[model samples]
Target: MRKVVFHKLCAELRSRALLEETFHVTIEEQVAMFIHVVGHNWSNRPIAFEFMRSGETVSRYFNLVLDALCILARDLVCIKSIDTHQQITSSHGRFHPYFQGCIGALDGTHIPACVPMHMQDRFRGRKKFPSQNVLAAVDFDLRFLYVLAGWEGSAHDSYVLQDALSRTNGLKIPEGKYFLADAGYAARPGVLPPYRGTRYHLKEYKGTREPENPKELFNLRHSSLRTTIERAFGALKNRFRIFKCQPFFPLKTQVKIVMACCALHNWIIEDGPNVYVYDDAAWYEALPRSVRNHTDMHQENLAWAKKRDDTAKMMWEDKVGQTVP
Candidate 1:
């Protein structure tokens, strides 16, 4: 985080009465300690030593700042607007009309978690170690629209999304608008996923291996646009060191930390300096989309599937017409 953005966050916290400066420790120091801990993944003892304060003091202020950030998240992590995003509007017919109703993309990520041995079975899944399945939505600009963390690693992505939608204040998809999701999610009314058993990932269309049919063409374009969420997750895990290892905090605190980090990520992006490094290409290479469990039998709706087919046919027809001699 930049110095200007740090001060801004502290000022915002104070303005909202989320935090106050004590005689022994100023709000700035308290926030700095919290940032150091999350940014460096330092434990209470080491953070206390670096801040020249007792371990108890470090832990107290860390939680205080964390609570404040969580409150701030309600404002930061949200949709910029309900209007059509400029990225799609300015796509020069690439995605303008076809995906104009797309508000953003949603995906689930596994954040390493530390749990007791007795409950490890429930937490262990695709990853070797236990983790939490965190679902997040991101717009074209890489800002987080919504986040739902704390689900066990063994939970399926579609199940987590269903839980999120069931919540009162969970992700809201306005009428006529939807989000692009990977095949891990069901093709519901407000959710769109690429066709299965088709060339979906962008890497599949490299070099001269262009999309051959309407399904492949639509999948190619869908994958290209849906990368926004992937990039958001990439930038997030890249910036915060805490995600690199399993946090020793309780399961509840671990979940709160994920939410706080996402909020802080948005704050730094919007209010702070724009020093965020995008691992667009590198992140894709690290985790090939082909390996994802797209083969899973999701409860795809017929209406949504027909909508996808219509969009793919339109896109393919346009491509064919433009290439005519």
Candidate 2:
């Protein structure tokens, strides 16, 4: 984090009464300790040695800062807006009119978890070690809008998303606005997923084997847009060492760490310099948006399917029209 952003964060914490200076340790030191621990994935002992504080004091301050940051997450870790984003508008040839209503992109990533031996089974997924399925929504600028951490790694991404929607203050999609999701999620009104069993993912569309049909074209574009969430995850795991290493904190703290890390990521993106510059070339072809409707599940599925088909048809026709003499 930049010095100015760090000072502002400290000030915000003080103003909000989330954290305060103590007789021995200042807020700056406390926040620095927390950042060092997460950024380096250092244990309490190493943190204590580095900060010249006792292990107990280091642990206490770490938890305090973690809690404070999590409290701050409620505001910092939210969608920028429901309106059409400038990223699409500015790049008119890319995702502008096609994905106009796309509020953002969402996906789930597994973060290392520290769980009891008895509970490891539930937490362990395809990963050899136990992990948690963390769901997050990120805008075009690579800033997180919503984040739901602590689900068991074994849990399906779709299940985690459903749980998020079920919460009283969970993931929300404004009417007529939607988020791009991967094929792992079922396509609904406000969550647009690419066509299953179709040619998706940019790697597949490489070389001479380009999209052969409307569904393939749609899937290709969907993969291109939805890759934003993946890039966000990559940058996050790369920045925060806690996500890369095995967490030694309690299971609950591990979960909070996920949230805290996401909040910090957004903070760095907004306040700090452009560390992770948005890749224009990578996001050349993009995604789709959706509407908020609670009609019958079958009907809603068909509606969204038709929506995808229509968008794909339009994209394909444009491609063909441009090629014609």
Candidate 2 per-residue lDDT over residues 1-325, each given as its tens digit = 7799998888888877999898999999999999999998777888888889998999898999999999888777765456787877775644657777997899999888888899999999989989899999999889998899989999999999989987767876766788999888887778999888888879887889977787887787778788889999999999999789678878888889888998899888889432332223232212223444556667977888788888888888877787799
**Candidate 1: RMSD to truth:** 8.2
Candidate-wise lDDT, in order: 0.85, 0.83
TM-score of model 2 (CA atoms): 0.91
The residue ranges of model 1 lying beyond 4 angstroms of the native Cα positions read 272-300
Q: Which ten residues in a row have the lowest lDDT in candidate 2?
A: 277-286
Residue pairs clashing, model 1: none
Worst 10 residues of 1 by lDDT: 280-289
lDDT for 46 in candidate 1 is 81
How big is the positional error of residue 268 in model 2, measured in Å on the Cα after superposition? 0.6
Residue 107 deviation, candidate 2, in Å? 0.8
lDDT of 1: 0.85
